[model samples]
Target: MSDEAAGRRPSIRDVARLADVSHQTVSRVINNHPSIRPETRERVLQVMSDLQYRPNRAARALVTSRSQTIGILSSSSTQYGPASSIAAIEAAARERGYWVSTANIEPRDPSSIAAGLAHLMAQSVEGLVVIAPQMRVFRALAAQPLDIPYVTLQSTELDPTHALSVDQMAGARLATRHLIELGHRHIYHLAGPQDWIEAEGRMRGFLEEMSASDIPTTAPILGDWTAEFGYYAGRELLRVRDFTAVFSSNDQMALGLIHAIRDEGLDVPGDISIVGFDDIPESAHFWPPLTTVRQDFAELGRRCVDVLLGPVGDSAPVPATIVPELLVRSSTSAPRPL
Candidate 1:
């Protein structure tokens, strides 16, 4: 049962011997030391692979005085954006041989955020990827200083140094402008919850575009970013009948809005055009196919890992900000004849 009785376990020395390098060089490669040359690093890693030389986490921690683990603080893992980003972060971290731990904090209370951080600390994570997109989350994080490095997956405007998020404002503008170009002067916005940073950016973009076009803005209908809420909002908007198009904050709400419109004997893109954000996989299969903005959560997640794991003095020069694109479909058209 002992390692020596079973042909002995490979150590850093074995890797160094096979790669024709010193044990210190092997250590540098394992720790991602910046001074190691690219060619030498590759050769050392190849020998490690050939020998199946897996570093022991316990010994490495004692030797390097750090955990090789990264923690993720996420808000809602059920939502598409947050869930996708979390998955991508895990994948990216695994590719670099770092373990990932996630703590989901739904409560907006400061104590909840603290509890989440405590959970990750118990695991001795070296760095953190924060996927809390609410305004209160940022306030909670800024309330105290952290010893370990942390990166945020929120609005770029929040933390210019470590933000990794898609341009929500630009995406919202693209959605709204699509309706405007189709000759829909009276447009309505179904915004998400007020606490969300993405919702704020999107609402700002919608208002900016509307004001720039000289069109008087109607009060936005705030929803909970659910298809059910969208349905209710759509049914209520029927009484007003003033707006020709509606841009929901996300695809779930947009689908619900379409259902409500159909139930009221109204046709999409004929009586009312609708646009949504976060082009979820099912958007294309919707009744008339959904026109929405597509954000690259995977790329955003990869960038988060790159910034957190890169060398201290040579961190990513620019914060990651993904640009969203408009995907046109059958869900939008010019206003019908009055």
Candidate 2:
């Protein structure tokens, strides 16, 4: 329908007029306020239905001193973790009748980060979710006090009260232990960039598991969470002596490693096995489907919004840790015989 033909959608005032009630009574019905009488509430609701009335979110927020909007500051929306988390938060907020405002942040600049936060504040958002995974962003958050409730997603060292994240360390341990259980004695780690919390957590998990097993640690191969970096790291490993299996920090990097290994005349599982994290959609389609850890980004986002909107009288902020599950696929196997 044409915008004009929609003929100016009906308003709360119109519903109130039809129901023979005050605007406040209509609002109480709309908000499901506990004090509203059942008969009065039903009357208001029926009138609203008859009039096709829609509440003006902004105007209502102003009257109640609430914006009913939440702000999200995120890194690239393409990456699996941040992207999935944002989608989840949006879905959860909508379920609760809240709106979402998003800001895309470049990882490098402090000013850009500040500007994004300023914009959300200007919009009068009731809460904020920070999806930046770097230490710098964490430092920025620490340096400033936020008037609205805020939470950090995937943060490793954040104050427990305000931080929510998947247990990357736990996920990594699951991946490493899976490989170890398959009789792969010489396991190597292909790590993500050191500055990222996901990378650090995965590395810690791998190390802890290896240490617990009394297996000597090999120097980790480093990458920037890119397919290209994984390819390079894979090529370098090809030049070194042998290892039975490799654990990559993410699915993209593992894919790169797979290609590089094949280019060097090796076959996955036949020559060496591989495991990856993130379990991106395409992981299953790889030449040999990838065995991986699946992080619940959506759950993380939902929990973040819940924490932000939770009653102030609730118990102190407790760090919530999400455990990732290990997905076994064709990419992993028992070690090759000597």
Candidate 3:
């Protein structure tokens, strides 16, 4: 039963040798210490990958109390936007040799949110990534006593220190303005549920842009961030058929709207131009190729890990809000001559 009679597994020294690094440097890399050089880090990672080396989490925790884990608190959502954010966070965490513990909760239920937080805390998570789309989630989280570093994926700007998010308002404005500049005076907005922070921010952006342009507005159709809801809303909107365009809050809803429009024998852009937010992968493949706003979910994920740990070195740049881009395609066009 003694080690002398058994074979030894790969050790830090073995990795150092193959990586052409000192054991100290290997330790720094394993711990994800900020002081390690990028080139050295990459080289060590490659060597470890080639050797199929995995750090002993239990052994490391015994010595350094470093679990090498991050926790994610997310609301249950099938919507592409929130789901993509969660996937991005997990991928980013794994790239740095960290494990992710995710706890899903209902954003509207304070008790559920509290329970989720308590569960993550019990694991002694080093940091937290909160995918809180609803304002109520923030309220619930703010009431908790948190000691670990936490970053929220939201544009609320309630806490500049702990908040990191895509500029939802700016992205919404980009979509809305695209419609206005197309000479479409009569336009509608299909917005998400009013309680959600992202939904509110986007709706605000749409209204602001419309008001600034001196464009008269009808009340936006609040949706459930579902393609089904978008379809139903589109059907209702076409009853009057007065508007020449619509800006959907997310791509799923836009797809629904597209379906409804086609059901009524209407053409996208030929009669009613459509614009959408959150350029999910399929957005690019929609019938006319969706004209939508593109969010850098992958970058947001990387920034979450980076901000949680802070800058790597003195010269490293701090993480900032990611700007969304507008993608124009066949889905939109200038209004037809009256």
Candidate 4:
């Protein structure tokens, strides 16, 4: 019978009875004791589900003094990069038998950051994952050192000790080098917003590569990391076919650039080659497919958890940087024999 039908909420005792295990075993399963047999854990979990048993976090905390939860503090949670990282963290946490609580706040406001941290602290989270894309957020975190362990997804010498990140600059350099190697000396760059750490890193990489090749360049068109900006930028750049290639800081802008090129009756890699960053899912299916950099967000997420919580049963040292990969697709090619 359902717990509702029984006229009382099911208890740990009820779960132990149904699963044919002792109450102690049930408690171990509840607390994610690593030594429990797989079959026994499954049986206990099944029974808990069948009885609609919800462990009282309050009572559990009182007894064990461990909340067994991880808090995620994100500033740009709505963006693809931050969102992907968050999903990866949640999956890794689940594998370790832990829960995740996320708090999103405006990165610019110190008060908002304080409030967000406070909200997470109230849950007694064992650790924290800070997805602070903005430098100010990291500065705020530095000012108020966290009581529990925390990890940040930043690499700009801001907090290298506690940082777990993909080498964004390296990824950008790879993209720029590909275009230059393709024999396209006249290359333009579509960069993200000025203040964003990622945008700055990518622009710097692009500039470094261009300068290293002894290629003179014009100012890059600053973009908002949107298809709309890319489209307009592409349209404006097309007015004078001065450049044979353009490297976009992100895929959305590349998509817009592609659309603008097609609208002008031009071709990708034929009239101009395009390369983008962040191989979002739809990039592969774009008209000619986008050539871009792929950030291993899933692995990044795993490392995020491992740094603060340590590997569940393994002993792998946390890496300084998870290098991104360049995905060369149909969007780029040698600038049509000059």
Winner by TM-score = 4
**Residue lDDT tens for model 2, 1-338:** 34653587877767777788998899888777999989999899888777777787767777777888999998767788788888899998987778899998777888888888888887789999988887777888777689888888777576667778899999999999999999988999999888788888899999999999999889887788889988988888888847989999999999998999899888898888999999898999999999999987777776887788873356565448888999999999998874
* C-alpha TM-score for every candidate: 0.81, 0.82, 0.82, 0.86
State which candidate has the highest lDDT: 4
Give the runs in model 1 whose Cα sits over 4 Å from its true position: 1-60, 311-319
Model 4 worst lDDT window (10 residues): 154-163
How many backbone overlaps does candidate 2 show? 0
Q: What is the lDDT of residue 282 in candidate 1?
A: 99
Considering only N, C-alpha and C atoms within 3 Å, which residue pairs clash in candidate 3?
A: none
Question: Comparing 1 and 2 by TM-score, which wins?
Answer: 2
Q: How do all the candidates rank in terms of lDDT, highest first? A: 4, 1, 3, 2
Give lDDT tens digits, candidate 1, residues 22-127.
9999999998999999999999999889878898776677678777799999887899889988888888888887889899886567888999999988777889
For each candidate, what is the lDDT? Answer: 0.88, 0.86, 0.87, 0.90
Query: 173-267 in candidate 3: lDDT tens per residue?
Result: 99999999989899899999988888888899999999999999999999998899999999999998899999999999999999999999999
